[model samples]
Target: MANPRNPNRLPSSSSSSSSSSRSVASPPLSSPPRITTSSRAAPPPPLPSAATPPLPPRLRPPRAAPPLPGLRGLRLRAPGGASLHRTARVFPSPSSYEFEIKEKGSHLLRLHFYPFVARGYDLSSASFHVSASGFTLLANFTTADPVLKEFVLWIDSDKLVLSFVPAQASSFAFVNAIEVVSAPKDLIGDVAIVPNQLEKFNGVSRQALETLYRINVGGPKVTPFNDTLWRTWVPDNELFVESDSTSKTLSFSGRIAYQKYGASREVAPDNVYSTARVVDGSDSNHNMTWVFPVSSGYKYLIRLHFCDIASLALNQLYFNIYVNGNSGYGDFDLSDAAGHVLASPYYIDFVADADNSGKVIVTIGPSKLSSPSWIHGLLNGVEVMKMNNSIGSLDGDASVVLVTENPVKRGFGEFVRSILCGFAFMSLLGIVFMLVMRLRAESGRTVLWSPLPTDVSGGKWGQGFPVASGKLEL
Candidate 1:
């Protein structure tokens, strides 16, 4: 190819020029190095919007550990280095689970199960000893030998918690433990018995004679038959005549006697020898009445004894006794009557209503007599006794005696009556005083005639006449 040489090329001739021109031939400068720029600075990168804040640096969270496997076996360690394992396996059953613990050390270790069964579990059959220090639990199961496949044990606060896994055989398999804590010392010390000091001589059987000797010759003074006064007397006397087989009418100082003469011995006697007497041959049917004044609210005892000396063939005898007017009667056989009989001078006890003011009367009659000719009678001793509620009858025949011993004046009704009487008396005196004053006022007299006013201005008649008024002439 032919090349155009520049004047600066100088010599070297056409041949060198021709070769150099071929090598130097190139395209012109390529349009001033072809300057290029990014498109509008990428539009200012679209200026971050308020809707989306830049995300924080990514953080990795901690991973959780795997759960522990379920418990399969249970065991306990004792202080003596002995270990006890549950030998009998407990299988989940329709009702309960059964298991056994092999005997371990001498010192019992307390095993507590929880979620305490509220009710309906037969804890009585379950063999376990719970002490103040601890407790042990045994499972009751149906299967001969089943394994306890799973269980959990941990201390939740003060309580020991245990939970069991459900068996595939049953939907509701439960295992529980009991919690045992030490008993308070205060509770342990409170268990003690206190004895009474005044209980001596309470059950002693008093002698019949001694009891009779204590009877009052006059009527009842205090509580009719107080404990110290008459209860012993009546019972002792009852013992005396209970075995007596005499056919003669036996009489004691008081109006107490057995009627041996009549076909049926009645307590109603034809004669009573006390100072206060009912006229002889009065109505025999009338209950022999006696009055022992007592405080209105005081309690008393009234006793009655019946004696009969006729025949023993009479099987049944009945008596009606009244206490404060209440009819209390019972029928008895010869033997029973004998049992009620007082020894020589014993007193039986009976109670009087504290509100009763009248005397107690005892009437004896045959409820059912085997023979009409059998002599049934009444032997007598009645006593009123005093006692507190706590000390009651000591023996079968011995009865508790409670007497009202307050004085007569203390009665509320009597007190009110006295006050009313005083007021009435005072009122009567006031009326009398008023009547006397009225009578005196009526008797005193004042002259009805009025004196003519003495002629202050005297009528004048010469020397003797008083002076008359200025215009008057005599």
Candidate 2:
């Protein structure tokens, strides 16, 4: 009530002196003007703390395994009962023809003619049959029906070659020109048959008119079929010859005393030694036997040709095998005696035991201590087959029979102990048939609670004991 008017009246003193003169002209406000906030220099210290990481070095141990190459397991045998399933064909003609021969009847063929034609024809009047659609050759003309113009035939499995070229004019010539023929005494040999209507005929040459007839029948021959079965061992002073048509080369020698693996040192020729040479006919005696041809159940592979001559330090020789004559080293002791050395040339494989035994004996030496020791050996060829099957006889004589041994694989703790004894005999017969059906359902629930206490007499629990306990609980 006394306010408004009174205050208004007081402030009117020049508005109270201009509100105390604007608070003394606000001049002493230094403290309020000191508001200077420009101090944020704390971000330059994050580049000096990085050096603590060095730990990863511990895992080194595993390196030592290299020494296994010494004819680990050897076996070799194959020479000449002859049919391990033989097959060889090379022909330009030295005369040999075999269309089929798994063993027929008579076999004796030998020819080594190489003079390049001096005039020789009559290869047995030429006629060999084998039917089944193979091996056929026929040529025999006198004159009247002469018209076979040009001819060149070749065969191999035995061998055959024929060459003839005629036809230029025609009249009738060629008299006693039989070159050579032999087969049951068909013997013929003259050489020079030219007359098919002569234009410029003599005996080869019109630039030699493409003529090359060579025939080389059957091999491995030296009287009496050369009695094959391969046998040759050189050491007894050496001097060999099974049959060498002069310089065909089949020589062998013997001399020993150069063992270093067993001490008695003297080494230099490049240091490493083992030598053997005898392809088929050398006789000295370190051991060599061959007669190969087995079928009864075919499976064969035998090879050996250990030759080490410019690096001698020998001491690792042990090989002894014999098939057919039996004795494949029984009670263990293939006899290494104390030798097992090798530097090269070693091939071995064997499988043949179903009774087609013909022959195979080999004995490489130098083991009983191997020193200056003395062991000479040679056997350059052996190969009995019947492996890939398919040649001919299981009953007729071509080849088909193999099963020599290598079948026994069942060990993982005997296949987990036969599946844990067949799952413990079927889980012990399913726990004895569930304990005999829980003791026959607890003896039929104790005979339905003792016949429901005698049918509760009357009604309460009776009625034949609730229909005989609900038909014995179903």
Candidate 3:
């Protein structure tokens, strides 16, 4: 008989008990639907379409062995949840897993590493390097908390091999579970727009991407069970910068309308579009902003999901979007973009460069084009994924050189600021030049003017212009 499942008793870093050998207790009550273990390699079973409910992930056990020949397979049981996380395989030496490819195309490779203490071993200290086919996924990776590394890689051959090597001979490697599922055919688009530059980024499907953040804006957390892609989406309470008083969360009761040539459920579940965070029309001082810390200097693929759940009619809501303070979309209209449909799902992809401060900021504000009565902003979801650098590495091994034809266009506010700065600099120069001329006149020496324009007059440059303005507002 299976014991009752306890969702609250989650796994932790340190376990209370230990044994000389690996402990293989009874499987958890909520085990995965199926676990395929065979002497031969097998490809993961195909999942249902996005319209159907998501089932438990089909995982193929990795071939692992301990250092000692006679030791039992190193496995530990988790107290609750799926069997995949309940038991983990520890590797004392280098190990590899070969999976047969059923469909040769882009596939999602997910590696789960949950740190725990069992059998007198601390899994958190295990340092390792992971590689898929030829691309290096992780190197010298060790973590105190559980982490799920997701990669979208192209599988051209019939077999896809994943190698796990320890950092050193004395060190070890371990993994809780592995998932290699067939990704959507159109998951990675061919081109992504550079937000501020407004240029097309071609060949985006060729590079590998690592999932950094999947945020459900203004909604509760959406776990894998409710998601069509078996992906987890976290709430935006901590990520969003606006307070509850300034912005409010809303949930829609109607069905989320998915249209052709638009974002489908495969891209993101309906749960994401059914709820939104909308700014208060009265609060004109602030915009709805979310910040995500990431590796500096790497280019990221930012996917912003939108739905008009807050509006009662078409063309009633409009807003502006910004990425890292750069203008992504100026006065974006939800109804017009979605073919005059309400509650329709829409998404935009932007290839943006992460700031040196190691953060990506997304902001949405009420647009001036909208009616005064409907002045507000809203968002549904946001997904930030890291694109592999030039050297084909996700984890900062080689510096990613930013290549762009058109530089970011400065805003009107910035142009105004620049003009003011130039005026200030010229005024200071004119004062210094006058002082020098005065001293030369007292000494009875010739004061020759330079070839550059030295006259700060009001003739052609603007009549009686004040160098120091009264008030310069942004």
> Per the 3 Å backbone cut-off, how many clashing residue pairs does candidate 1 have?
46
Name the best candidate (by lDDT).
3
Residue range 162-219, candidate 2, lDDT tens digits: 2211111121112111111111111111122111222322211111110111100111
Q: Model 1, 1-474: lDDT tens per residue? A: 111110011111111010010000011111111111111111111113432222112211111111122323222222231111211112122221111112111111122221112233321122221111111122221222211111111112332222222222222233222111111111111111111121222211111000112122212211111111001121122222222222222333443333233111111121211111111112223333333333333233344433433223333333334444444444445335454332212222344443343333333333443234433334333333221222221111211111111122225556798999999999999999999999888866433442234444345344434443443222
TM for every model, in the order presented, reads 0.23, 0.19, 0.68
Clashes of each: 46, 48, 1
Q: Rank all candidate structures by their lDDT, best first, as comma-separated numbers.
A: 3, 1, 2
Local distance difference test, per candidate?
0.25, 0.23, 0.67
Off by more than 4 A, model 3: 1-82, 243-245, 398-474
Candidate 3 per-residue lDDT, tens place, 1-474, comes to: 111111111222111001001111122223222232221223334433565344334332223211222322255666665655666766565555566666677777777777878777788999777777566678777888767777788778877766666665566777786666666676778788787894789877777888888888888877554554566777886677856238888988788888888887778888899999887567655688988888886798999999998777888888889999999998999898887888999988888988768888899987887766674788999988888877777875722221100112224445788999999999999999999999988866544432334356555444344344233332
Full-model lDDT, candidate 1? 0.25
lDDT of 2 at 304: 28
